[model samples]
Target chain A: MNGGLRHILLALLLLTGLNPAHAAEPIKIGSFLSVTGPASFLGDPELKTLQMVVDEVNARGGVLGRPVQLIHYDTGGNASDALRYVKRLIRRDRVDLIVGGTTTGDTLAVIPEVEREGVPLISLAGAIEIIEPVKKWVFKVAHTDRMAAAKIYEDLNRRGLTRVALITGDGGFDKSGREQLRQLAPEYGIQIVADESYGNRDTDITTQLTKIRASDAQALINFGFGQAPAIVTRNVAQLGIDLPLYQSHGVASQTFIDLAGPAAEGVRLPAAALVVAEQLPDDDPQKPVLLSYKNRYEAQHGPVSTFGGHAYDGIMIALAAVERAGGTDKAKVRDEIEKTQSFVGTSGIFNMTPEDHMGLSLDAFKMVEVREGVWTLVENAD
Target chain B: MLEQLFQFLVTGITVGSLYALVGLGFALIYNASDVVNFAQGEFVMLGAMTAISLVAVGFPLPLAAVAAILITIGVGLALERFAIEPSLGASVVTTIIITIGAAIFLRGVALLIWGKDFHALPAFSGDAPIHLGGATLLPQSLWVMGATVLLVVLVRAFLNKTLLGKALLACSVNRAAAQLVGINVRVMLRLAYGLSAGLGAIAGILIAPITFSSYEAGIMLGLKGFCAAIIGGMGNPMGAVAGGLLLGVLEALGAGLISSGYKDAITFLFVLMVLFFEPTGLFGHKSADRV
Candidate 1:
């Protein structure tokens, strides 16, 4: 081999060897989320928030006098990518803590690897499947789909709509949706009429809509993400179907409006307390925290905040726990997180327990309506 | 029950027309040049977005739609000349992979240029849901179905009747022979690609009113159309149409009778079963070797 090339190769190896020892000097945290993919809409916001919180903590004299170093990967919302990035973070990056990934499928897929590695893994998505088997190292910051559904049912019970038809995509979000809504329907005096489900990639749902139109339902509840909800909105409008559409929190974005046009107006749904804090006045209790986070995030990144709030909450709690631990010991940090009590978060007051990795409950669901391209709070606290 | 059945059929036919149009474009390219242009979906996306942009800028419907189709045709010819001809005589799978890579590149370019916002192509007719015999159908959907049927007939006539079309088919069958027969096979290849892109652009424009336009919307639509082509065989125009319509019906039935959750699964399963059991396809000729 040439002398210059040989020297370069040796230097690279030496740098690689010195990198991990370098990583340990700074309290390292890893983040993996869908910076690109179907769930990128959710992951992008979370990533923005994660970077924001990391910056904030570092500026405030990071935990234990060591600034937190964040290593991140884009999982692309693929389970295989999650496994790959998990391996990369643990084996290569040598991160002390791991946070993120915004989809149920990816989070659940990586549970086995997280356990095998024994690194503290906190999920940004809650599919109910992630925390149930209870791996020693796994914790989740997002509320489970079941809890979200339960909250919706309780809130809608008082609403005059008795029969509701569903239009949902056949995806991971739809799975928990069917289970939770089906079981919770009778409890709320709501009957599911003419429910329709389309594929995750299906572009049209006219057949489902026609059936939905013929039904005696007074309202439509959509459970899906992105284009699915938007497609439904446009289709319903094009078909001249006038039923009020209540969408899953997954549809909380301008993406729907961009796709659905004027059809997006007046749609009702449940969302995180923070994202729609615009509906709450300046004097509202939740306004200050949400606005501050939103402003800081927009200034740092752009105007997108979904998993950003969850991630911000996740990092804050994780850092708080690390401080309570007085060190980066995994168990002590976990213990401190478990004892989180009424900790005001972008979503709600999170009070996590050892038994429950997800601190917030169904009570976190806040009813909101889209009016003139803006999401407004609908007062329905069941 | 009857209402649900009606709804499912309307949904199936509207979406099926789009798949058929896209599959027909694939068939045209495959038949003429023996190349599967997997970037057919990008043409569709480009058409939709182009039309949407023009409409957003207050252009007339006919002008925007025509511009979209012409632009796509230009893109197709450009791609065939630069990418396909250079890699001519390559293996089928290699061409397919190249096209897939091209699809990714096109998607990235679209994102970089237009951003990742979903946009709707305004319906030519005003938004009024028309009820036809207990079934509600959108006006845009009627236009799509009408356009699809028209394209099918137009394609059949053009391929069977036109001298250029005959020359193109002759090239597909025997390029060297066609060249000896005083046919410019290179021009035929360009013609095939341009026509394919034109047809896909039409589908993109026709369906944009309902499906809306986005940079990445073409990915799933392309996959579904490709699956339809698989069911129909790669090169047969009739098979492509039949396969598209059949898959649409199957998806509708799956959505209506069975769990709506398994619609795509059923369509994929149908494709798999056909490939496994009847590799020649429902109506396609043995254009290539199978095994």
Candidate 2:
């Protein structure tokens, strides 16, 4: 470092240390999110929720008697960019902990960096692989695709739809969801009679649907995100397929309904309580939490997606860990995060453990159906 | 058995019509200026996004579609003037690279204007499916197919029968000779861009309901359309339309009968086979015709 800059940094540190009213330095929380790219739908709200939560925390006299500083960078959904920014967050910004990575690719790309640096990272991405086999110093708030698959299977079992056909998109999220569904099918007493896939950018999936139609499957599950799920919804209707259609939580937002138009009617999916916050019972523990997050987010950002709710749970979990740790010690904070238990947040009641970094279970997801162009809770998880 | 094949055929034809429109656009610009406008896909995206925006602002669907097509045509003309025309006398490879740059710029502009959200345009007709002997077809699919037939006929007539169209063709035949015959080569090139843009917009508007429209939607459609042009013969408009239909049918059958995983691979393998057997494309004429 230059002598002049080093001296200036030392002087600023001394000034903060000398201040009587606020002796403790601000705790630095770093983040890198896909705020402006194709996955912005996930990262934009994530960034917003992080900023809003940090602001609210600061307004409430900060965490542990010190101001919280959020140092964030927009990775634009690129994995390499996410890694570079994360390294900078650790080496340059010297943040105490991190609480972002909008997509699974971004999260996985920075996993090795955060692990080596011993910084606590609570990712917002949904892939189970992020936390599977338990990487120390890493936790994620979003319910993995495995949870989504189990929740859907639970719903299917309730309805006695034993034979299920799978149509998946050839994308990461869909491919993972497809794998989880296939692996968990036997456990759920469901048979995978037909399994087909389509390209992400395919315009027509009728041929695949037709093949599925010929199968004796009693239900259809589409594993995909983006507009492909919407297209599948439409094609199912056009082909006169009478089987029940279930979509993955990857498309739990109203944008899916808007894109699918009337075809979204009667489609079921496993989603967070945030999507149907108003419909939750008054006695439900997550009701107040979901409603507050929904109202606060919608008040400023127009709508609330489950993606943003994941961020809410993530930052809240991080701050709660920091408070429990009593200081910005990375090791202590990591342990505190792993010991998180029954913390009611928007996505679910997270109960992190040393073995399971992602604390959400099948109960975290509520089965929802599209009724009259709005999300209606089908079954509330107890 | 046969029912499955019939269903695949119906679906293939409906999707093929869209590829034909976009492939026809590629063929038009290629024939006019010998520069493969990679921005052709952006034209499709612009058309769909513009129409959706127009409808959102309370324009009727038909009127919005017309305005969208006109707006996309304007974008095409602007692209030709600002990006393509400026690099006059550049190598073919240079001009092609310029179009790729144009495509990226157009996509960026679209991302800024439309954001990253996928916007849906309501179907031109009701989405009620018509049962064709156990096979089902959407009303929008009919609109797409009928519109494709009408457009292909219109474009063919304009190119083969009209004076201005013939002048455009003459430029493709021999730019220097056409210039000597008092043909305004620049005007012909501009017309090709305008016409190609209009075709792309119509394709976008027609398929937006089925596929939905987003800033990135054009990338795949454009690539498929380019493949259609290649399979048909780059310079052959009729060949492009046929190539598009053939590719779509092959893809559908490949997915349905063989494996969905190899759908694209199978289609590309066929394309490669054709390219290997017939380097001039399925319908491309020999060099004697150009001379």
Candidate 3:
């Protein structure tokens, strides 16, 4: 009986080895995203974009003549789930690279794992901490919150609106945005006249807005994510606060405009050029890439968001590095990614270096105003 | 400075009216059955979300609002019949636990139906702001306040004047005694649930324009309404309304005049002080219990 089992096992092994001519070894790319939870708005678009680009790449003869495989897990917005999935990606799937981490919390949770496992990670989150104290194997494609702050400050400075009132939500993203805006105010010759914060789940913010209306702020800056910013927009309109209102990139999606309704008109925010892709000047380097992505995505999905733009850049950057390194050698890809320069992407033209992993600058952001319920590029503010 | 205070008051009163409406629902249910209905907020959420969905599907505003309230009442009655009635003889803590479980289940169902996106209802009136003495007010604020006052009076009259209302109050005082007096205790419980659900639905429809609504929207509103009921002596409807207004005004004034960062902290601290000074609540009367 033992001899018969051994002969059968040897015959099975030989049969599997004989079928190797099906295709070249696939390049496995893993991801963990918050695709069905509170952060699903961010992750859903990101997953779609990644899937779309991977299909398009494979259709174009695949990357490095091998089909690209995306092995993804839905984390449901839990940081612990993200860490577990990242470990599984590295140890089980044996993916060459990872291109996800839909939130700052999830990205930060998996940094140590990616570093230890010697797999490169391309995060799609927007936090300064993700790249400031740079991890060796970790990189992000989204603009830092600090860059968003600086871009807003630049617009305010150009418009001669020096005194700013700040209304913030007490969530992690909003708190970080408020801090960046506050810390960068002095550099742009701006003064924060009033500072008010509300709870993340607080239904009413009229009290805070009343105080802001009572202040002598020349411009108002509201930093928050999710539904709070839309509520703030409505309250600002209701309170009749006439100052120029500025929001962070946190509320850059089309959903914000829909939720805020007409009150969203005239509100300005620093956002990726992907938002106003159709309106971008023809000479703009990002217009072609943005339009192509916007068209491709909107054809499959109903609407295109900047979050999806981040993922598109992430996979493209990863593939570019793989090409430059001649293989998915982790260390070589890391070196090539660090040496990247002038790579035009949906978010911006990236110029990576050892010192600056998130290579996009403030110019990657465009100060766009809501005009008649649509994004109008604010040329003078730039 | 005075204008700022007035603005804060306007904002506070608008916000308070919502809390009062929700608190009144809590008071109504607690009075009818000694069990606090933790799913009260889900009623509010279901009302607004259903109304919004109805309007999206071609129903007129008034029709949608009425239909949404009826649907919410049905849900409340169903909850009582299916979940609470089966466990009628359970301890108060167990009943409360059941209601909490029901609340979570309702929230999960809402998530499945409406997803996690925040949805808004158009204002009943125009979205124009009325400027008065260097402050501004949305027309919807007036609607909220006016409707709240009317509902408070109506609810008070219902409890004091109607025979059915008296039956509900009789249930609150002593369930065994109420059952002995030829009252259908189960029917009274069902009535309490339905009435409170209607009240919660109205509150949701009124505030949807101002606050927006989501599957999880009821969590904070419910907590604040519970605080209102607790601060105003848990079983007293009028007291709960008063407690809600007081909480709203204090929160607004504190955030406006003091530190905005400490707004929630200040409100909870005040609630704690009230509880410390009077264990029976500020408006609660001393009662002797016989074993």
Candidate 4:
């Protein structure tokens, strides 16, 4: 009877042991993006890029020979929605890592949960505050608002335009850009002559444009994204203000020009090279990567924007760390991500260190002007 | 300072005219049926989007504008027949809720048809700013003001001079008496909806060149128009025009003289002050309670 009991215990152990060897577990990568709602323009393309890259990576025998499984949720451009999904992804889905947060508000909302859960999160938002205090487990991929303001200021300095008028929306991204532009103006030898703001629901801004027209500002700087920027362009033309208009990197897509019509001509903005990939010089390091991304994206989905490029950099960087760590262990993956250096991406060359989690500088931007409704590289403007 | 004042005045009148047109739409429907049609603003959206789509498909601008107005009338009539007619004898709150649902349904349909992008129509004339004493005016502003004046005159003539118009007004004053007097009060309600929708379409086409139109543009415009109707006193057409202009001018002047951040706040504050001083509204009549 004792021999029979020992054999039964051995059989149970064998059954459990054989289950592990039958199939290799897949590495799970979860994300929450603003796939619909007001910010869908940013998130829709991002979702497409993530799907494409994940498919390509898995086809090549994903990180450490384990297939990649992507779990995605749509945030619908709301902060509370992002938080709820992040919790589910951490607890229920049991994902190895997370890559998401298309907008700044969504990204900032998920940071606390991400830190407490001990999951490595690579964000795609443009807010500097996300990385400034540097939580141990959080990192970002998009060019920050500070970098955008610095890039615009550099171009303004080059053009010798000192007096600037600032117009911004009340959204978080616009607020951050406005703050950075105000703080960094004096250091760049720029003087703000007029500062104006408008609400998101406003139908007309002729009053604000009239004030800007009355100012001694030599250049008008608009720091808002979406349909509002188009209204500003139209208002500028309607008010007959002939000062040079400089937009922040927020209006970096063709939709802005399409809405503004002929009024978009001569408007300049600092944007990522992906906007004018075909116009880049041969020796530029980002040329090949931008072309490949642009071609692949446009082939699958009609056109590509810089917003999608942020997601590309995010997923690629996260996967690179996974490969470098040689496994899906969370602690080892976090360390490998911190040690990432000289990684070329569509946005810019990412050289991450413990001190600088963003790993991108002002050099990521290229000054481009809208010429006849298309982006034209402003030669030698840098 | 004078230049700033002139600039503010031009912008105020331009925007005020748009509000007036939308308010007129509210006033007409309120006069015929005791029910307030909350879907009035969606009429404007449909008008503008339909015209834009028609123009894109190679119709002449004038032809497209006319087509848009006709199509909007049909939609308004259909809304009355399907959504409003079935709820006859319902309470006021129920009718209002039904109209709100209609507005949401229209907005959703527009989203599926047009997608989520702001569309623009080229100005009827050149886009040159007319310089006047250091303040410039967009030609579209002139178009808006002119259209409002024309609409107000036509509506006034229709209400005061024509027998059919008088019959519609009779229905508003006493529906049971109008029906007893052979005025066909139900027909008057349908006519009122048709006219209000036509007015809304004209307003949409006129303002689309300036403000641009998207699927979500109607809600704020609808709310503001409702506020104007209240400020001018409900069921009064000319009062709606005055209320709309006052609201627009107040908003523009507040933005220019005080703070743009408080533009919306100032407008609502004025509305509240009016409600406190004159609960019936600036031009509202003092009617006895029915009960």
- Per-residue lDDT tens digits for candidate 1, residues A135-213, read 6778887767777676666556666667888777777787688777888888778788777787766777776776677
Candidate 3 to native Cα RMSD, angstroms: 5.5
Cα lDDT tens digits for candidate 2, A1-382: 3566445545644654654444457889999999887688788888888889989999887876678999999998899999999999999999999999998999999999999989999999988889887999889999889988998899888887799999999987888999999999989899999999999889899999999999999999999988899999999999889888999998999999998888899999999988888888899999999988888888987788899898899889989888787667799889999999999999888888889898777788889999999989986433
Per-residue lDDT of candidate 4, residues A1-382 (tens digit): 2565445434544655645342346779999999877787788889999999989888886656567889999999999999999999999999999999999899899999999989999999998889989889999999988888888888888888899999998888889999999999989999999999987667778898888888999999999887788889988998888999989788898888887888899999989989998998899999999999999999998779898999999999999998777667799899999988988899999999999998987778888999988999997764
For residues B244-263, what per-residue lDDT tens digits would candidate 4 score against the true structure?
A: 99999998899999998888
DockQ scores of the candidates: 0.51, 0.82, 0.67, 0.64
For candidate 2 chain B, which ten residues in a row score worst on lDDT? B282-291
Residues B58-121 of candidate 3 have per-residue lDDT tens digits of: 9999999999999999999999999999999789899999999999999999988886678889
lDDT of candidate 2 at residue B65, scale 0 to 100: 94
What TM-score does each of the candidates earn?
Answer: 0.87, 0.94, 0.91, 0.91
Ten-residue stretch with the least lDDT total in model 4 chain A: A15-24
**DockQ, model 1, C-alpha based:** 0.51
Model 1, global lDDT = 0.79
Instruction: Give the C-alpha lDDT of model 2.
Output: 0.89
Candidates 3 and 4, the one with greater DockQ? 3
Q: Please, what are the lDDT tens digits per residue for candidate 2 over residues B1-291?
A: 899999999888888878887898898888888878899999999999999999999999999999999999999999888987888778889999999998999999998888788999998778888999989988988887787778878887888899998888888788899999999988888899999999999999988988898998889999999989989988788888999999999999999999999999999999899899987789877756766
State which candidate, 1 or 2, has the greater DockQ: 2
* Number of the predicted model whose DockQ against the real structure is largest: 2
